[model samples]
Target: MLHGQSNAWAIDYDNVYNDNNLPEDAHWVRTIGAMHVYNRPAMYPEAENTNWYVASGKAPDIRGGIQLVGNGMVGVLGLNIGLNLVASQNVPIAIINGAGGGGAIASYQKNDSGLNAAYGRLQHRLEASGLKLHIKAFIWNQGEGNAGDAVSDYKNALYQLYKNLSSDYTFEKFYLVQTPPGCSASSGHQTVREAQRQFAAEHLAVKIITRHGFPENPLFDGNYFLSDACHYHAHGYEMLAEWISNMAKYDFYNGTVDYQAPQLVRVIRESGKSLSIEFDKPIAVQPDLKVDGIVYSVKDQLFAINSKKIISISELKVDSKNNKILRITFKGKRLTKGAVITYVLGDTYPDTKEPYRGPWLVDADTGVGAVGFIKTID
Candidate 1:
């Protein structure tokens, strides 16, 4: 099962660089808005009009089965990849896409409204499918809409959604795709990300895939977005599909999967020139780790650190008492009032192959790092 908002529904398979054909054994059903439900077999074409008006198996366009509607690329690719992996072991598979473009987490609660009113149409599809078939996993790729929501509210709402779905169906595992770093307008992304991190940590059956390094657009540079900087291109979807398929295979086969990211909890100043950076989990700091910062004249003001004098770290050590804390001492004048320090992970040593340039501080086991942090002196 697949569910989420626009990013989950956006499709750009036609623009994919390499050959990304659908699997022969895969089939899908989609709930369109509140009124229409379309079913399709595998190997559906991309040229057909993906609307209720189109008939299945029509010439010039194969209409039956799942058609790429709007920017709905990744869901189909992900499903194909998953089913292919399962079929390699002689297992037959089908998928249900119960997603709505622009759908928010709040809209899909037990009591629904808008396109999802009365528990929305997704529930209807799930109920109908649940009667005869058993669900394997619930793959969720949402949270872009909830980027502005309070962390607690988003967490609670997501938990409720999980509970409601579990009660309605029997699924072995739940996979959540961490929100992409596209929604910069919403300041609550970090909060939501933290909420997701915490929730996944507490739940054993839940797994989260990271979207840390995915480019907003693959074609051009200069902040080029896939589509409006929020959605992804076909290649992006394909990469996401690769992650989904791998996770699905592991979970389906009862294999243990890593689903944790290093979390930055706090940054405390121990002295005028020293600071203690804490993480929720233990981290392995690379020997090549470097720190570059600007001495801000005013606190809470954002500026281009490149133009200012760069402060170098005199010492960076792991706390012997607590592995989660990093003792950082910089060689400079004591930090005074109204001075701010900032450092971005992966900026100095960016890995083109890594996700988000690989987080600065990574877990020894998973190599996922805590989110970057900033400190402002009072």
Candidate 2:
């Protein structure tokens, strides 16, 4: 299902998978791929298992066009992942060994480091290739390694990761896997989960996939997880994958946009003569409008109202219900009942949140204190 212009490659910094597991006759390794780069696992296994059969070597220098493979979690370190991502244009999807017993921190560290590095690489490449990379969604599930003091860092770590990804990816959309239940809501894992929610709330881009109300014993038994208490034994991973895929396929705001009322509304008056504006809440005009453009003289006033920009208002109506009025610039002007006037507002400049001023204005009505509407809006 990996559709692109490159072959799959496995880079293992964790030593989670080895050559013995992928010998010429080894089914899993051979079937997986031939390009494998094994690194010393940040934390190697206690008693070697069937999976850790590969040997570590001088890591390969991945240039580009390579896909990544690993166990479920990654997103901790920056360098290893950065390199992995640099080796490929397609965002790397890793599959790690799911049986490690380090609790939340272990999995989180590995998964987070890998994911973050990949994102960083994607950002750099997108910038160079003139391509825009956006995160449509995410699938995260980890909790075993987060049992103690290491737990406090979990939430912030995840939040920071999200912040970095959103900034680099230019898209904030993501999906969060709730920490599995039955681990006592007061546990460190639970603490991290709460932090995750707080982070999601502060940003408009993240959504938590509900693992709440999930039956414990009965459901686990019915779902085949009864055999393995820690990780998903039977159909859990499949079910989880299906759920994540469904969410990722659709817009994250599928049914949640209506609940959020617009908050920040602003207007830019290039000519400084416009005072008409709009926002989620009303705003007052500056007593004296002043906007400096590339080449222009004469100070003009501007205001944003109801998320719209208005110009040349003699005065404004005070609304206490909405603390909006800031200044009063338009007053004591000639009365032109319906005579049109023109004013300029801000312009959209890339990489800057600041709106630029445009001296040009269209047909706008003039009046002693008339509110001129925005003729052309960006």
Candidate 3:
């Protein structure tokens, strides 16, 4: 099952977008949806003939909700997952979307908001398919709604939500996609992100896949979308599904896949205007990394510091002697006392065009992208 907000349902969820990147056998694997965004197999007529018709469910009330008509539609995430599992594990599967957009973590809980009537919707879908007791896992992409909430509160609420969800369906594992950046409601984008990290760490069954590695396309065919910073395009959603399915394949069926990415674990202040970021593994710089809000300063704010600021990057590269520690040297002033750093640092990305913003690193050998982090220096 797929869960969470717009990022999960997909902002650019046009049938063309979904069909453009689907695997060959997607339609053969049956699928369905909760209420908000259900699946149809029009793309693969074979699947419709062999499986489900579009469910007669009510459309959700989201800012950009796709108006449904008699025409059929395909789920960008589900069919991709189905095809991947079939190709690799040789097992057929059906995916369900239980997610609704514009909802915070609290809203999706047992009895919080009407949107979570999705829980009831989910129950109905499963019963209709005769799989109320045969669910395997839940793949999710959320947290933007809870970005403004207190970190600790978000943590407990998300945990409770998980426990509550487990009560309704007997699913075994949970797959969480790390929420992408850009929440204008508050600057707490990183706060929600950190809380998600902690939640995944605390739960053994929950596996986290990073969305920051792919490209973020705010515009579809030259149209600018508000979802630019946070939501990804069809390609982005496709990669996310691929990651989730890959990890699920490895986790559930003992298939071997390299879905793990390099993670930032430590940060060190090297003497004089330099900082060293340590990753879990040796890092490889695939492209230039641009970060936001950098300044050189002294131990105290009272002291006069270098006036030059890092609006753009000076240089972000791996140190010659150390593959694990990426050394960054700022222009002009030395970084000292009271200084901090952040990632993808501006309102707009004027640099690279890769999906998601820069500051993206990866495992040197596997090329698996590194996880984008919170305000933490690493």
Candidate 4:
């Protein structure tokens, strides 16, 4: 995972990972904060299966499924976990923190010239990498600068920024995180929140995650803040990180539909070795074979898999003792050498209003990751 840390956000990645007892796969790197303008410190990390690219003050070059963390407002650890999820899922993510505190949009900067410049530089570097990099999301968490100026064209700029960024990037998935609840001076904490909410409503791809209900421990308790009444203390940072983690984990898109099934399913086994698979009227997507959870996807939705290792179930014969079990005979070849043939079955939901059904099938050594079949036909 990668993150950015500056005056507003202090992230010690090693500390967070170590404290959490995370596995070694959770490798991460950090970017220096607001004053850092060069790319030297950011791009030097050794690339691994998952890479987190974070920016505190400016945007950095990122490709593949790498996540870019910016916006000085996101505390070090909060950004860390978000990066971790993106890395694990191998998806691209980008975070843009408006200049912090009293800044336009209620961040630190009265102007966003730094952010604008950073955006331009990041775009150029990404293009230079020869990778088809696309920006999919944006996270905003600033509003201190425009406290009273909420009445100004602040709303227009916010929307304009999204429009302009999206013009270059294709993905509409955007998230607006409200500024922390407490600001010492006159800040547009509430007004900006309203404006952000309004922006999200008007835009189909945009949504808002509220910080209005966040605890005000740092603002009220001097102990929770550093000498400066603006920044948070260690404990406060942890709380903020936890809040961001929750936001990252929230799934606005859960399109679970009622599954309907047909009758007369056929089973095709295509593995060189035979695998033992049982059929259930209402079978779990991926049954537990060993320990680790395996994720399978027919389309884009996440489904369970038995495991990564392929188990051998040889000389399998289909016997239809009951009229309900319909089995098909097929020639067996080799499955993937390392991978086993997991069960492929029709999905049946017991609670559906309509008759639920599907056919389960499997294929082996026909080809690499052979497509086996158990299709349901009415």
Candidate 5:
């Protein structure tokens, strides 16, 4: 199932901008409003009924609330990519699209009103499709409307959406697109983005499709926007579709997906003044922990040992035997028993070049941050 806002709906590809050409091999169905259904079958005897009809390029209006369709052009490039991925593996794919253009996360809760009512319709269509197709994944590309919402509120709402979907159906994985860099200057954008990052980091089943290295379309002179600064053009959509395909292919081929996050496992006292911090996974250590031939002092990188209190770290070294462990020596006062160390708390080190110095530890391979944790010396 594909859900979310305009991005998932492909609002940018409205009829005015481009034609919605149906792919020849694509076989899919879609729901219109609450009761009507439309199918775009690979072979046509064009299925039609009082409630069902054959879908055309422009049959189901983009403005219509909820829909389900075969993996065809259907405006949603991402869904098309998903369908193509399934087809490549010689499998049939059917998709249910429950998306609203300007919808917020709150609108899709268990019982939401207004345009968000699409969620209810989406559920009805899924139940109505008695094919008993095993759901593979729920592809979500939203969050722009909530760009101004508080991070905590957005996070909670997002979690609820995931829970709501899980309760409604059984699916293998959730593919969450790290929403585009919309209104980059908006505080809500950053908040929601960070919340998404943190959520994906903590949830094992949630696989995030990052937009980090995505390039702007050269057709737009490398500008991130298409016709509007908020949406993407054909080229941008193609790139995004490719990304979705890659992620889908990875998940489809392997029973398990790769998630890289440097998790803080525990903190052990090596001696009176030395401490060893262990992470759940191996990490990349900066070979040269020095700038301009001078070793960076513990005061420079070490943020806090216990309770946000700044303590000078006389020496800091990655353990020789275990790259996941970092050994630290205090300059003056030794850490007392039960001293809790906190690093990268909130968005503290906003400008730090080294991720290890920040509140969240970063995995070298994926550059994904580890969930921040508080560890007490034992």
Candidate 6:
């Protein structure tokens, strides 16, 4: 099951998979904005498209599964999820999506007093399929519309959603995709990201999917990663689906793989002149940040605040002894306990055409970026 706002619905040049050539009994549905369900059977050999394909066959297409009515925004990730599953495990998968683009978290909630349209749509789709009450998992990617709400309020609402969904449905796991850093109009975008981080830490079997990979050039005219600042291109959606499939492989299928993205395990102000930003796992320095011949300094996105005096960061690199610690260097100066450190500042660009702008330090092999954070030096 895939749910949430625009990213879930998709805004891309094209879908990751062409739905016309999917495997047997692999079907999907979409209830983004309105009901557009698809029940097409594009039966082909399991090995046909090893990397990408959509869903098809053996599902009742009650109400014509996934018809793009209005602008034909066709990049629902359910298709890629099904395709990857079938390709990797040869198991036909079914995906049910109930998402609305530009919707508030409150809107997706279960309102008992009145007609809950989102809830109704999902229930109807579940009933339409044979799996009336049970789903394998719920994959959620939301939080652009809740920009105005306080962090606490938004989190409370999300908690309400979690409660309602768990009570109302029978699903194994709930995967929450951390919101992409884009909504330039407000700082709420970062707030949403932070909220997601905290929420995932507190919950169990609840994984936070990092929708990473931003443009190498922060000032690029256009990005291949996203259709716009907020929405995803096919590349963006593909990255997201990859992680989802990765978790499934490692957790459920017992596949030997490292699917987790690197996050800040601890940040140590190791003396005055330097800070050791340690990750949960071994990490490597992304050697060149220069994009299109422009020198994009990694430290520009990083901030180290010393109240007594201003200390400019001289260098940021992987620690010599430890692969996990990001060694932040400065001239010989003492960083006090109350000094603050923040990453990816100035993330939003409201006035201009570009909306989301930030920097990242990525995983060595996978290129999965580290989570953006703002924390006081301790």
Residue-pair clashes per candidate: 13, 65, 6, 35, 10, 7
Between the candidate structures 2 and 4, which one is better when assessed by lDDT? 4
> What is the C-alpha lDDT profile of model 4 across 183-228, one tens digit per residue?
4433224345445545655787764543222233434432344434
lDDT head-to-head 1 vs 3, winner: 3
Off by over 4 Å in 3: 11-14, 17-24, 37-74, 112-116, 127-134, 170-172, 183-188, 215-231, 289-315, 319-322, 331-341, 344-347, 350-356, 365-368, 375-378
Quality of model 2 by C-alpha lDDT: 0.32
TM-score of each: 0.61, 0.35, 0.72, 0.43, 0.58, 0.77
For model 6, how does the per-residue alpha-carbon lDDT over 103-188 read when each residue is reduced to its tens digit? Answer: 67876777552223566556555554556466777888888776645557877888888898887777777888877667554544
- Model 1: residue 36 alpha-carbon error in angstroms: 6.6
Q: Per-residue error at 8 for model 3, in Å?
A: 1.0
Tell me how candidate 1 scores on lDDT: 0.50
- Show model 4 residue runs off by greater than 4 Å: 1-23, 28-78, 83-102, 105-116, 128-133, 215-225, 234-378
**Residue-by-residue lDDT tens digits, candidate 1, 152-261:** 78889889988988887788778877664554343435446656766676788887666653333435431223435555555566556655665666666654644344
Candidate 2 regions with alpha-carbon error over 4 angstroms: 1-132, 149-152, 170-172, 182-188, 213-223, 252-378
lDDT tens per residue, model 5, 1-378 = 777766666644444333346554444433222221222111121121113322222223333534433222234454456445655665555555555455577666777432225565566556656522467788788887786566579788889888988887888888877653443333325456657766776788887764433343466545435434466555555566666665666677652424434556788887777888887666554332332234433345434665454646777767789778877787765667788775433221223322122212344554444434445678
lDDT of 2 by residue, 308-353 (tens): 3444455454345644322234543432223332222222212233
Q: Is candidate 3 or candidate 5 better by TM-score?
A: 3
Tell me which of candidates 1 and 3 scores higher on TM-score: 3
lDDT of 3 at 69: 18
Candidate 2 vs candidate 6, TM-score winner: 6
Considering summed lDDT, which 10 consecutive residues are worst modelled in model 3? Answer: 296-305
Leading candidate by TM-score: 6
- By summed lDDT, the worst window of 10 consecutive residues in model 2 runs over 1-10
TM-score of 4: 0.43
Candidate 1 TM-score over all chains jointly: 0.61
Off by over 4 Å in 1: 13-20, 23-74, 80-84, 112-119, 131-133, 184-188, 215-224, 254-378
RMSD of each: 9.0, 21.6, 7.5, 20.4, 9.2, 7.7
